[model samples]
Target: MMIEAAAKMAQWLRLEDGFTLIAHTSPDGDTIGSSLAMFYILTCMGKRVQVVCEHIVPYLYSFLPYAEAFNTPDTAEKSYKNAIAIDCADKNRMGKAVGIYNASMLTGSIDHHKTNTAYGDYVLHDENASATGELVFHLWQHLGVAVEKSKTALDIACSLFTAISTDTGNFSYCNATPGSFRAAAALVEYGIDIAEINRLVYRTLPIGKTRLIGYVLSSMRLYNDARIGAAILLWEDFLRFGAIPEDVEGIIDYIRDVDSIEIAMILRQTQKGDFKVSMRSKRYADVSAIAGRFGGGGHLRAAGCTMQGQPEAILEQLLQVSTDALGQ
Candidate 1:
């Protein structure tokens, strides 16, 4: 029986069978955090499991526990008894990892995105969740893990905490519900270094990333009467700064932080010579719908898509989409 709750749905996995856990491609802290937390929980339950992704872990998240354990599709198992996507809104988000997930005998997902396509059997979707980790924390509770003993399993706590923190913007994003706060509070009591983790995730950055941020800020352009702001990055920009794809993480937040900017954007050139469009809204306007028009989906406030065209044309299309959305 699939209960509507994530914890109950999680019970559908058979302990006797081995399975694969997937993190979405270009994984963020939320996906990695939730995947690692589940990896620990399922392992402790004596279930054989592996975590896989389509890309290498970003350097900023490398400090996370179990971060080194992610397997790429080239190295993952041929098939599995079960597969569960962690924090992915849709199967497409799984990228190359989706192939292995599909080959499994059973499939499911645990996610908190509003734009979720609702794929997978026994799926658990909680848009109200501050992060997927909040639902994961409940899974811990379902398995009879006592809050008092949560500290004893430091890896589990750290992984869960990291997931919740990154998704909530360290409890600052509007998505942080009371339940989210409660989950984070309980997880931190498990002996994770809250200050150090925060410093690492938010305050600290590599020299190359810092240079990239400076470039983005200096090159930022405003539209829609200065309500929309964008920082466009060509492949050449990355080469000039010695920046990798990982370095582009969180660059959009800086633009979104502008007082007059309601919509912040990043136009990054992907390896395939195409532009990857990322959008974030401050007050209103569903950026996800705009991204969705281009075959992408995410939250109302944050979303993205990839486009193959001249940079300026892509930006104009996105602007038109955003303007139409804002008009509505």
Candidate 2:
């Protein structure tokens, strides 16, 4: 069935000379790696490929293969053909590429997020997959596309490896099963520097991010009798510390560690006055279901939603919803 989908997408690709691959709006390693891997694959097949995302690849991850080959919507506005969305659960998360996808001749989606809405014309979404890279790998295998397994040509493997490694929390999350490890080990055989990957991902953070985190930790809140940890970051907090969107990436994990905490929620006030919420769960809680109620979604253990209101009001509403989910 997956092969049939890939074959159909490949046929659609044959109708056009070029295509655009859109990662999620705010890209992480999985999104970036999946997009670049697809870009490289399509380009090698003599299909012109462009990777379009809102932000540039972060400095630390710029060393990924073919990182230099991305194009912005502004750059490829007139020339692109099909639209392929990767690591994105929904079309709105496509960000700058959303308009292009709507106007494109063909649209295909590839993702591994469990909460995916199946938005594209050709969607290959597998929640069991640790990352979109794994889906791409399986799809490639099914389609009978031959990739040289040489150490020197490990671009796709490395990309998939990074995607799996990051989305599964370095393969420590519950989603990292036997198949996940097998896929990762296969990538290692392609000569990925596993040690370097760990160092680069875990040990690297901007100085500004450190200070921003310090502020959040100092003012943390514990709710539901400390069984649920919560935190609030007003726009003023970020302004005082020079924090950006990416700096607040892993703060939810901090709250998830509280003893007996079934759920954790982090609410941050974006500069635009909208509230951005991040959530994590310890066990037996389906945070993605709650997030879906608010028009956002992610993995089972972690999810997020955005709302239009002050942080306090939004937090009150989500607390009620999250508390209800804890009982379920």
Candidate 3:
């Protein structure tokens, strides 16, 4: 059942002595930032907590405050009494960490995804939130954290700023709500190192990921009179370029940025020897419905689903769906 009383969610968290905070697989800015923000909050309350993820925290995100708090499921100690998922839409997205999350005596989640499956015992979710970090900002109001600038406040604000900034495309995407801008403005008052964050989050790119970008551009495919664009990250590409899972984070958006593309997708070969597609739309196409057709869910503009098949055959199949979606 959906949790109705918002304060109860905060109360549930307040009552816990320790917690295992889980970030979804691939560890995007929103998930990592939300997890770290909560980590700071819970620690400040004298609670023992640790953040866990399925994979190594991406280098791009390691500069954030409490970046060292993340642990792989195997490495994380089992001392936490409760579990809470941050920014995860579903349990499967928790990857290997889902085992610990399931075993907790008390379970909760803080998420903004509209496709959330209500998998937690207590869920604080708002589909209208621009980012899960934004939801965390509001939750802090109830937790007795002052809005004044302090070291703790600055750290919290830095994480929240990254969460809101990256998820909303640096405040340029349509998802950037008034609340999103307002939260950013409020966070800015804490004096987060915005210039350094901009350089790390946007201006910096590792050589491996840089090379992978070249491969993606050179190998991109356009279909349906250039209305749809896609790039495939083959298994060999990982080995040849030494690119990690996080390296592929925003590659799909690059495909969608093209002027003629209505739908953009990235067909990636998962480490488990299966395939999954990350999708995005420029306008008007309900990609969540398309991803839902194959047991995936996200926002109208972005979504993804795992699949098992030959990659080439899968591309052919998705092209037909894209064509039908666009009435081409």
Please name the candidate that would achieve the greatest TM-score relative to the true structure: 1
Tens-place lDDT digits, model 3, residues 36-138: 8888888888889899999877788889987976899999878788999999999998999999998889899889898999887888899988999998888
Q: For model 2, which pairs clash? A: none
Return the lDDT, model 1, position 13. Answer: 57
What digit string (tens of lDDT, one per residue) describes model 1 on residues 141-248? 777644355443788888889899989888987898889888878877777889899899889877778999999999999988878998789998898998998688
For candidate 2, write residues 189-257 as lDDT tens digits.
878788888888787778778887777777777777776778888888777887787689887776787
Pairwise lDDT winner, candidates 2 and 3: 3
Task: Name the lDDT value of residue 213 in candidate 3.
Answer: 84
Better of 2 and 3 by TM-score: 3
Which model is ahead, 1 or 3, in terms of lDDT? 3
* Colliding pairs, model 1: none
Candidate 3: where is the Cα deviation over 4 Å? 1-4, 212-256, 260-328
- Higher-TM-score candidate among 1 and 3? 1
> Over the full model, what C-alpha lDDT does candidate 1 score relative to the true structure?
0.85
